[model samples]
Target: MGCSRPGAVAIVSVFLAGALAMISLVLPYWSKMEIVTAAGEKIEVALGLWGACTSVHPPALDTLTAPVIANGSEVIAIEPESALSDSFTCGSFYDDERVRISCTSFRELANGQCKRREFRGPASLCDVATTASFLGDSTAVVPDATVSDWLSVVDNACHGIGHTAVALAVLSAISASLCGLLLFVGITCGAIESRLGRVGGYCAFATATLQLALAVLWTAEAHPIRYTEHAFATSFYLNAVSILLHAAAFVAAQRHQSLEKEALAAMDLDGGIHADGAATEDKEKAMGSSKATELVAV
Candidate 1:
């Protein structure tokens, strides 16, 4: 192929790199989560796989029995009815209190102070719902309606310069720079008709595309209101896929350059033979001239 053929590879590489950059920036925003407060306020939360751990927990001992307090001071003890109802699991905890309430917010009593409640058996002390609202008129009853504010807190934390966000930023910058370099190499190879360069360009393009896709997928799967297990799994899978694509592309580019060099060497050898044949003809002509001169002189 002519040197210009590699131009296509360069073009592809650049397009891929641009895509990667766009996705890297977009994914974070897409995966953002928001918490809606009981007062109808919305708080945006940015969370990754690590943040999921804090939101999910093991269920309290009594899943069915709601905490009952007497006169704002006495904690009630329940008799062990059955192990089936008391035993808690991670999913159970997520479903019961953890999913519905913010970990930082404590349940407030009628006097607007945080209420302290005890658990019977091996129950979690953090199970009491902390979120509350003013009752209609003047009566204070713990509203059955509880709001989950974890998303808000998580969003607020993520919005700040946190470890996860900072790490992501650093990773994205590095990947972007590497991608740009690969594209430049591919372009240079195209100019020289280097087979390896074309190949490298192709590889760079492929990797950039994959990286961008992963970022997009991660952002798309994140929800502002709800937390699901599938979101976490999808995020991890996307990241893995991106990494694999990046590696594969890099290898392909390198191999392409190697092949190009071999082809170039072969061409040079063929040209050298033609030049050697011309030199041989010139030598024969000179020898013939000397013999003719000697014969005439004799």
Candidate 2:
């Protein structure tokens, strides 16, 4: 059966609201992963490589030393511009086998028996090898596989949780919309029969119940909720809007019932006559005038 004008409007409003809700939920997450890298830079390589490595390995100190001989000299010198020592203090290296290495170093050199030194140091030639040895020990390299596995676990959990929430939201919206439609149809049809009123009441009650259930489920899913200022404000706005829509629906439904009751009472006063019946002549005129007055006031 066709719905009344208000019922049609309600259905359209619900659909539009659902569309907007989906957009609100999905757009932010979509924007978050947009690539902003400079030309020719591998964005994935730049962002993912370090994070993947650091997931399993402890972060290393910023500076280190490596034993390097200058010319034919046995004396080891710290490369002034090594990854470990450069003032720029960025960029990475690949070993002979092309394995990526993130490291740093210090300036100055030492000789003789290498003595161990701290990351920052007083230096003598003998301290060079010792500093190199210490730096070598500071390499906090983690196995690539371990890092990958850790990332996979995190990705899987986030993916599953996010999809589940979206799915639930969609399902809830559909259920709520269908229930609302049923309630609208029932109320409009209720004037014709008592059975229709019973149906309408049942549908309206079910819609409210299901909406409450979905709200409860959403709260449970978002448990231990920590609300940022923005989230709190947005939630408050949504709640207010929902309350307004519900109030409007209730008011409309009540007015519709009142109109139907008055129309029925007028028929009774007209001796239960149809418009074609002679008895309804004066009563029909009075009823029409009363309805016109009610419409104008409304």
Candidate 3:
């Protein structure tokens, strides 16, 4: 049997979902904030699983939306330059082990150097705590916030959470790849009831479910202080779209399987009726031949 329309569409959806997953994995724009400075300058900060990126935007841009105004009354003012300090700040605050962590946004080379800061690396929450301790004054201040105190303040939210999230994301990608492989084989063999097809559908659903969890965890974990505006960035949105695609693929695969099973059942029924008719005709012919022989003998 040739590949059904639903099967073809499911395969396409799987391919697209895998592509989106890969792209989202590498790009570092999971969460974003626009910080309005005291000088009317805007600094955009993007946080990702691997790293963080910051860019200075001029206040003259009228198209800027989602501005987190730092008016000391509404949105507490934070020093734009001090917020995501350059790699130099990491050196001043963090020791040698923590200082070397490099997290550049989208892997871009800023001034031919990577953005090396406490908040840029995969262990950004831990690093951010250290930086916050050094900064002293914060909009969200914990009384007597030492480095360890800050850690406890957030209830050790950074402890292995980022790494675990990264692991889950990778697992999601791997599952998606396996799903594509199984789906491709099913399409080629035209087997609707193939165990491979069922497994592929399971994989797709698993990927979607895991990604949804990751999205929720990331949103909950990415709340840094002193910013009023918050939004999920392009990479985050891409993963979300990928999740939907995977879900759609699962539905299509199920439909294709059902249609193929029904067709197979119909074919079996028709073949059984034809066989019964042929057997009855053969039996009648044998009876007539015996009667003719007996009459000749008489």
Top candidate by TM-score: 3
Name the TM-score of candidate 2. Answer: 0.33
- Model 3 / residue 127 / CA error / Å: 2.6
lDDT (0-100) at residue 221 of candidate 3?
A: 61
User: lDDT score of model 2?
Assistant: 0.35
lDDT (CA) for every model shown?
Answer: 0.41, 0.35, 0.65
lDDT by residue (tens digit), candidate 2, 33-96: 1111122111111111111111112222333354454556443344443422211111111111
Best lDDT goes to which candidate?
3
All predictions: root-mean-square deviation over Cα?
Answer: 15.7, 19.7, 9.4
The local lDDT score (0 to 100) that residue 259 gets in candidate 3 is 86
Q: Which ranges in model 2 have alpha carbons more than 4 Å from their true place?
A: 1-171, 180-205, 220-230, 233-240, 272-298
Candidate 2 positional error at 81, Å: 23
Stretches of candidate 3 above 4 Å error? 58-125, 128-157, 189-193, 223-227
Ranking by TM-score: 3, 1, 2
lDDT of 2 at 188: 51
